[model samples]
Target chain A: MYKIKVHVYLKENILDPQGKAVTNALHQLGFNEVQTVRVGKYFQLFTDNVDDIESRIKSMCQKLLVNEVIEDVDFTIENAA
Target chain B: MYKIKVHVYLKENILDPQGKAVTNALHQLGFNEVQTVRVGKYFQLFTDNVDDIESRIKSMCQKLLVNEVIEDVDFTIENAA
Candidate 1:
């Protein structure tokens, strides 16, 4: 099987209110060194070996896993036992 | 500055309905090779250099970034321009 780890996050220009809130909370908690926080989604997928796994995974991301207009996605695929 | 990437996921034995839903959706989309899908949270934090950054980051995870009861967190810290 192949193990795919995907990370989807907001575009750099996009506002991330959740991340901002977390930053503020961290500051209030005495972690003043924290400058910024960006939140995103992570996914782990286990799939049977297939032809052109990279393209297939990318298609999956485009079709169902990510909103391309606002989010950017990157993934790493590795062999799994 | 230091860049920290944090990943938080539910405990192995915990039920992940959201992941299950995504798996079903993928199957519906004809991606039958997909065997399992696990979803988690990802966070990127930018922080000023500090003493014992590793320990401090761990503290942050324990105190605010993770529930620790049902979720597990792991992070990587690196220097950033």
Candidate 2:
């Protein structure tokens, strides 16, 4: 099987409230060093097909994995077995 | 500021319902190639102090960012300018 790892993050122009909350929490917890915080998504996927995985993953990201309007997705593929 | 990127994922032994749901959806959508799927968290953190960012991040992961029992956390630090 092939292992596909996807990372999805909000675009620079978008606002992330969750990230801001975390940053505020850190500051409240005495970690004043923390400035900005943004949260994202990570996925680990196993696939039977190794051939054309890049294209397949691209399609997956475009279709179901990411919201193309607000988030950007990137991925890496590796041999699982 | 320093940009810190954190990736948190469940250990192999743990079950991920969200990943399973996504996998089932993909199969229903005709992507039967998918075998197993696991969902995780991603974070982008900005910090003013770079001198001790690594240790600070390690502490953040251990204390507030990661559960440490069921999830594993990994991170990278970069100059955010």
Pick the lDDT winner.
Answer: 1
Strongest candidate by TM-score: 1
Model 1, position B54: C-alpha lDDT score: 84
How much is the lDDT of residue A77 in candidate 2? 86
- What is the clash count for each candidate, in the order shown? 0, 0
For model 2 the local lDDT of residue B6 reads 96
Give the DockQ (C-alpha) for candidate 1: 0.87
Can you tell me which runs of candidate 1 are displaced by over 4 Å?
A: none
TM-score of each: 0.95, 0.92
Chain B TM (all candidates): 0.92, 0.90
RMSD of each: 1.1, 1.5
Residue A15 of model 2 has an lDDT of 96
Please, what are the lDDT tens digits per residue for candidate 2 over residues A1-81? 788889999998999999989998888887888888899999999987877778888888888999999999988888888
lDDT of each: 0.92, 0.89
Supply candidate 2's per-residue lDDT for A26: 87
Q: Which pairs in model 1 have colliding backbones?
A: none
Instruction: Enumerate residue pairs that collide in model 2.
Output: none
Calculate DockQ per candidate and list them: 0.87, 0.80
Candidate 1 interface RMS: 0.9
